[model samples]
Target: MTRVALMVAVMAVAAQIAIPLPFSPIPFTLQVLGVVLAGFLLGPRYGATAMVVYLLVGAVGVPVFANFRGGFDELVGPSGGYLLSYPFAALLAGLAAGAAANSPRGRALAVSFGWGCAALAVIYALGATQLAVVTQLPASVAVAQGVLPFVVFDLVKIGLAAAVATAAAPAIASSRA
Candidate 1:
C-alpha cells in the first residue's frame, strides 16, 4: 500500500512536466515513462491502483495532471481519454512484466519490451477512438493528430522502461531473497 501510494505520488509529479508541443495538445510529458515504471515496479494490480489514485487526485483539482491542470472539467476535456487510459496501460504493462518475471533473462527482457509496446498500442487505440468521438473526426485523422506525432517518443519511452525494468529485476529479487 505504501509502495502504491509512493508510485502514485511519483506519477503525479511526473504528470506536471508538460513541454507544450507546437503541433498537438498532448504535449511532451514524462507521464508515460512514469506509468511504465509504476507498472514494472508494482505489477498490474497495484500499478493500476496507483494510476487510478493519480487520476482521482487530478480529478479532484489537485493540479497533478499534465500541464498542471486539474479538475472534473479536465477529465471531460479533449485529453481526457488519454488520461483515463493510464491505468489500463499500466495494468497491461504490469501483466506483461509479471508474465516475464519467471522466464530466462533474455526472454524476460523481450517480454518486457514487447509488453511495453503493447501497452503503447492500447493507449493509442483508446486515445484515437475517444478522440474521434470527441472531436467528431475520422479515426484516421484522429490517429494522425494523436498517435502519429508521438510514436517516436513513445517508442523511446518503451525502450527506457524496459531497460530500467531489466536492471531493477535483479535488485528486486535480491531484496526479496
Candidate 2:
C-alpha cells in the first residue's frame, strides 16, 4: 500500500542519521523511531509487513541500513539481531497502539510508552544475543557494549514515538476513512 511504502521510505531516511560508536558495532540511528512510528500508525500486521519489506529491500543491497550500507551482510553482521527484531518490535508496539485506540490521549500515551518500552526490550535481547554469537563475545560484554549504551537514547526515542503516535493516529485513521 502507499502508506506501507511511505513507511519503508521513512525508515530509509531515518537510517541516514547514523553515529557509529568507537567500541561498539551498533551505531545510534533513527531506525528505531521509524519502527515505532510504523507500528503506531499501521497497526500490527501491516507494521510488521513494512519492516519485513524494509529488511528485504536492504538485504538486496538497497543501502537502506545505517550509514547507507545494506546487503545480506548487514543482516548477518553483529548488529543483525537488532535489524531482524524490527518486525517483532513493530508488532508489539502496534498491539499497544491498537489497544489504546479511542482512549483518552493521556491513556493512549501511557499505553504506547509501556508497549514501546517492551518493544525496545525485545530489540535489546535479540540484538545482544546476536552480537555475542557473531562476535564471539561474552553475553555480558555484548550487553555492556551494545544494550547499555543505547538505553537512555532509546527511552527518549520511545517517549517521542509514543507522543507522536498518540497525536497522529487519529488523523491517520480519519484520512483512511
Candidate 3:
C-alpha cells in the first residue's frame, strides 16, 4: 500500500516535468518514465494498480496531469488517449519484468528491452486511435501527430527505465522478502 501511494506521488511529480509540444496536443513528459519504472519495479498487478490510482486521482481534478492540469476534460481531451493508455502500458512492462525475473541477469535485461518496445507500441496504438477519433484526423495524420515524433524518446525512456529497474531489482526483492 505504501509502495502504491509512493508510485502515485512519483507519477504526479513526474507529470509536472512536462514539455508541451508546439505542433501536437500531446506534451513530452517524464510521466512515461514513471509509468515504465512503476511496471519494472512493481510487477504486473501492482504496477497496473499504481497506474490506475494515478489516473483516477488525476481524473478527479488533482492537478496531477501534465503541466498541473487535471479533470475529466484533461482525461478525455486530445492528450486523453495517451493518459488513458498508461495502465495498459504499465501492465505490459510489468508482466515482462516479472517473467524475466526468474532468469539470469542478462536474460532479464533482454526481456526488459523487448518489453520496453512492446510497451511503447501499446501506448502508441491506443493513443493514436484516440487521437484519430477525437480530432477527426485520418489515421496517418494521427500517427504523425501523436506518435512519430516521440518514438526515439520513448524508447530511450524505456531503456533508461529498464536499466534503473534492473539495478534496483535485487534491493526491491529484498525489501519484499
Candidate 4:
C-alpha cells in the first residue's frame, strides 16, 4: 500500500515534469517512465493499482495529470486515451520485468528493455488509435502527429526505466525472499 501510494506520487511529479510541444496536444512528460518503473518494481497488480489511484486523483481535480491539469474532462479530452492506457501499460511492463526477474544483471536489463518496448507500444497503440478517432484524422497522419515526435524520447525513457529496474533487481529479489 505504501509502495503504491509512493508510485502514485511519483507519477504525479513526473507529469509535472513536462515540455509542451507546440505541434502536439500531448506534452512530453516522464509520467510513462514512472508508470514503467512502477510496474518493474511493484509487479503488475500493484503497479496497475498505482495507476488507477493516480487516475482517480487526477479525475477528482487533483492536478496530477500533465501540465498540472486534472479532471474527468481531461480524461475525456484529446489525451484521454493515453491517460486511460496507463494501467495496461504498467501491467505489461510489470509482466515484462517479472519475466526476467531472476536473470543475471545484463540479461535482466536486456529482457526488461524488451518489455519496456512492448509496454510503450501498448501505450502508442491505444493512444494513436484514439487520437485518430477523436481528431477524425487519417491513421498515418495521427501516428505521425502524435507518435513519431515522441518515439526517440520515449525510447530513451524506456531505457532508463529498464536500467533502474535491472539495477534494483537484486534488492527486489531479496525483499521478495
Clashing pairs in 2: none
Candidate 4: regions farther than 4 A off: none
Which one wins by lDDT: 1 or 2? Answer: 2
For lDDT, the strongest prediction is: 2
TM-score of model 2 vs. true structure? 0.96
The per-residue C-alpha lDDT of model 2 at residue 109 equals: 91
Residue 51 of candidate 1: its Cα lDDT? 91
Give each model a TM-score: 0.93, 0.96, 0.96, 0.96
The window of 10 residues in a row where model 3 has the poorest summed lDDT is 96-105
Worst 10 residues of 1 by lDDT: 20-29
Ranking 2 against 4 by lDDT, winner: 2
Q: How many residue pairs clash (N, CA or C atoms closer than 3 angstroms) in each of the candidate models, in the order given?
A: 0, 0, 0, 0
What is the alpha-carbon lDDT for the whole of candidate 1?
A: 0.83
Candidate lDDT scores, in order, read: 0.83, 0.91, 0.87, 0.89
Model 2 alpha-carbon miss at residue 39, Å: 0.3
Mind giving the per-residue lDDT tens digits that candidate 2 earns over 75-169?
99999999999999999989977777867766989999888999999999999999999999999999999999999999999999999988887
Kindly give the stretch of ten consecutive residues in candidate 4 with the minimal lDDT sum.
Answer: 97-106
lDDT by residue for model 1 (1-177), tens: 898899888887887777886766567788888888788877889889999998898999998888788898877776788888889999999986667787887888788888888888888888777778888888888888889988999889888988898889878667656
RMSD of each: 1.5, 1.1, 1.1, 1.1
Can you tell me which runs of candidate 1 are displaced by over 4 Å?
Answer: 174-177
